[model samples]
Target: MKAVLFANTDWYLYNFRRSLAMSLRRQGYDVLLISPPGPYGAKLRALGLRWEPLPMARRSLNPLREAALLWHLVRLLRREQPVLVHGFTIKCAVYGSLAARLAGVPARVNAVAGMGYVFTSSQMKARLLRPVVRGLLRLALGGRGARLILQNADDVALFQQAGLVDPQHIRLIRGSGVNCAQFALATRTRSADDERPRVLLACRLLWDKGLDEFVNAIRQLRLQGCSLHALLAGTPDPGNPATVPEATIRGWVAEGLVTWLGHVDDMAGLLASVDVVVLPSYREGLPRTLVEAAACGLPLITTDVPGCREVVTDDVDGLLVPKGNSEALAHAIRRVLEIPGLAQRLGEAARLKARTQFDEHIVIEHTLEVYAELCDPLAAPAESSP
Candidate 1:
């Protein structure tokens, strides 16, 4: 069987899908990674996976441009003729799934990683344009022709309720699973001079990621005499409507509450210096940062939302706070700070959870099972009479 994977960025393919791609290749499937070419594109080629560069625009919302993109993908789908076309993210899922269908591709799988700002935010676009998008999604995902792969149950439920997907074809594959071996537990090494606890926030600098809330929480903690040092990684997405403004992030740096490192190349090295990992994102699809952090033996603090909740069991592996609530975020930070022993215990539990529930191997095996059932629908076990 041949499979073509379509996404926006090379970095996403490297960070999230590389292990799965390698596993697929080992299973003797002709797997190819297609995306906009970049430095990470070179890395994909080096890993011996076929890399095809398509002019995929990641940011534009223009109708004409999107139509052009869809036509281009349809042309590629016709030429490649892969057995299955797997699409990720919002744009790729929308355009790729439609294109694959138009080109008469055998099977189309849409992986809804996270709903993204468009669906999660209460912006005017979300209010006015969301229904239009959902109508398009129904056309793209509904019925027996394709399967919609949801990363979290909350999203799956929403899509089902909205009639965007058929319940029979909706499959839940929790977050892109992490490789526990690669992110094995590491010992925290800090010097006496670096006595301050290191708190790290690793995600896109988006307002909906709760950056404003995080900043306010940090400021509140500082005002209340907490001396934790903080670092913010990840890039500011210029095209995203929810992106945190550069000037605002700079102002925070000016006040010295947190240090901003624009785009990080060495996430593991950065994770090494931190005592705690925090992602107070308004919503998520099993955040990869939390899984990686837990694997590295760092305690977690995340919002009590769907995907985030899957990674950290509240009061067990990590602390959870109300989404978008600064007071709740600040209080959680303070609680983690007051109890040093809790960090170690939670970190241990998080490592175990990553190994047991979020391991890459388990995810790959389950995914392959789904593919097998897709290939041989008759061989798949029938549901018990109900």
Candidate 2:
């Protein structure tokens, strides 16, 4: 059997879905990947997976370009003639699903990782395009053999309410799961002589990720005489419109407000040195970093928003601050620092939650089940027409 996975960028496929692809390959499927070429394309090829480069403008709105993209997808799907086609993220999902239907693919899966910029951004452009995008999504996902995978229940509800998808076709599988074994509970602890607590905010450096809010919160904590070490991990995504510019990140690092650790490869090792993990993102499908942090037995502090709240129970496993509120974030950080034993208690609970619910094994098993259903003889039939 052959399966083709489509994504916007090679980097996304390498970083987020590599494990899933490998798992599928191990299950005796000829796994193929289709994405825009990037540095990671070679790396993916090196892993012995077939890689096809397709030009994709992730944020472009030009109708001509979009139409060309759709045509290119239809051509590729026709040539590949794979049994199953899986698309990740919004644009790929919409275009890939439509193209798969046109190519007469047997099965389709659209992973709407998050209601991205069009849904989260307050910008006028995003607002203007929301309805149009919604229409496109409805048309793309309306196929009979298609299944929609959502990372959070909030997104599932939003799509259902918008009449973009039926409840029966929606699957709520939490964020691409974290590797519990890889991020096992830390064995080390801060020595008695070490008075300062270590805090980390690891995510793509994007404006919508609340990086500014996190920096301001750290500044507030420092001004209030709190001596804590703050670490900013992950690199800026230049292709993304919301990316925090390199210059701004440099300025912050130079000012000595936070240590910049760009694109951490060993998150498990890094988590061992930190007392708290924070993601003040404005929104998410489900923040993968928070779930990984939980697996590493670290307490979390995130906004009380859809994706963040799903990973943390307010004051139970971790603290939840108001979205985009630097002051509230600062207060929460201070509370985590000042309250003796609170971090430990929260970390313990978080680790338990990770083991029981958010492990990668669970995600892989569930995803394989979906694939199995699609391959089953009794699976839903394909729509007669596109």
Compare the candidates by lDDT and give the number of the best one: 2
Question: Pairing residues by index, what is the TM-score of model 2?
Answer: 0.94
Model 2, position 329: C-alpha lDDT score: 94
Tens-place lDDT per residue, model 2, 52-87, is 998688877788998898899899889888888999
- lDDT per residue for candidate 1 within 1-386, as digits (tens), equals 68888888888898888888999899888998888777898899899998888876677778898888889888988988777788888778888888988998867777888887678889887778787778788888764657878888888888888878789998888878887776674444676797898888999899878888889999999999999998899888875788888899999999998999989876777887888899998888779899999988788999999899989889899999999899998888888878759888888999999888888888888777667656555323343334
Number of colliding residue pairs in model 2: 0
Candidate 2 achieves a global lDDT of 0.88
Per-candidate TM vs. native?
Answer: 0.94, 0.94
C-alpha-based local distance difference test score of model 1: 0.84
Ten consecutive residues with minimal summed lDDT in candidate 1?
A: 377-386
Global lDDT scores for all candidate models: 0.84, 0.88
Q: What's model 1's lDDT at 15?
A: 80
Positional deviation of 26 in candidate 1, in angstroms? 1.3
